[model samples]
Target chain A: SQQGEEDPQALSIQEGENATMNCSYKTSINNLQWYRQNSGRGLVHLILIRSNEREKHSGRLRVTLDTSKKSSSLLITASRAADTASYFCATPRGKLIFGQGTTLQVKP
Target chain B: EPEVTQTPSHQVTQMGQEVILRCVPISNHLYFYWYRQILGQKVEFLVSFYNNEISEKSEIFDDQFSVERPDGSNFTLKIRSTKLEDSAMYFCASSEDSPNGYTFGSGTRLTVV
Candidate 1:
């Protein structure tokens, strides 16, 4: 499968703590995107990093990409209870293939 | 911000029956895609439509599957004969430019009994 693989299938942290998720894909990509999904809901786009860039930040979220390694990581700083959700990294080939996802639980 | 909308948020159907999931993608977007996630599995790409034609489709989108714009505002996915294994949350997404970002709908939960 050309799908990306995410590490630490799950993570738990206290409120105000930071949470990080990583993704590795086997093939070259045009861009990588991160999404967050609450239980039984659709995914919300978080951030997108191009092949040329190494890192990007949006609000409390930060994303980093390493093209040479074909891996990417997402960081949510000062995570809140509301940030508890499954996060997925999508790497684009002909179509976007998602990782198994990392389920993050923020304890309040 | 404009969001994609899907009708019949949840649908229950019998095996072998035809099921159609409808999506109204964000207006002005040029690319549309369909994806499905099983109860505990990763989201799998089903197909992508552009320029009134299927730009790319995964093997999962076999002969049993078909897509159509139907009218100016709606996009539809038709499963000719549904199977029990087809039960999953189906998501419809649209993006102004691809490999960039995407906006997704709440999703239609398909339950094939």
Candidate 2:
């Protein structure tokens, strides 16, 4: 079974708008993580929400996890051109598995 | 902030040849991992290392693939014999623990011709 799968494969929005991306997974998990990758660069750690936690926030990023629904979402408020990147959700079961990221393009 | 550093941002190798990718993870991290991304594809886990040995590996990590943390600081992945399908952007990552956030290197793009 595919572990982490994200929706809205691509998204484009103007600056100052809010961008939301969702990720779903199969099987149970202890926690889920989100990452952002600039083109041809490495992934940067974003936020991590545990199975018991419903919401988490850091700066302009907000993450929510629904263990019962087996899904999670990332919300970036007031997006900027610098936020243009691919976002992936990950789950670890010994080894971390990533979803087919959501490519977000925030136009300036 | 500390970073995971990978060498040779890009490499071109002939098919059937051996290739070794190197990474220096964060000094205090206890867990290290390797992942690869084919062009326009999702990231795939190759292997995870901890306690000086492999903790887990993906099906993609076949007999031709091997990993080592030879000198405690340098973690390496070696492909015994490369294939055309082996071309991808390989990333090295590390975390203080499995449940914590990981720091990833910029990745090494391997091209098998």
Q: lDDT of candidate 1?
A: 0.93
Which portions of model 2 miss their true places by more than 4 Å? Answer: none
DockQ of the candidate models in sequence: 0.81, 0.82
Q: Pull out the clashing pairs in model 1.
A: none
Residue A56 lDDT (model 2)? 97
TM-score, cand. 1 vs. native: 0.97
Model 2 local distance difference test score: 0.94
Candidate 1: stretches off by over 4 Å: none
Q: Identify the leading candidate in terms of DockQ.
A: 2
Judge candidate 1 at residue A91 and give its lDDT.
83
lDDT of 1 at B10: 99
lDDT by residue (B15-107, candidate 1, tens digit) is 999999999999998899999999989999999999999999999999999999998889999999999999999999988888676889999
Candidate 2 lDDT, tens digit per residue, A1-108?
688899899999999999999999998999999999999989898988889899999999999999889999999999999999999999988778899999999999
- In terms of lDDT, the best-performing candidate is 2
- iRMSD of all candidate structures: 0.9, 0.9
Clashes of 2: 0
DockQ of 1: 0.81
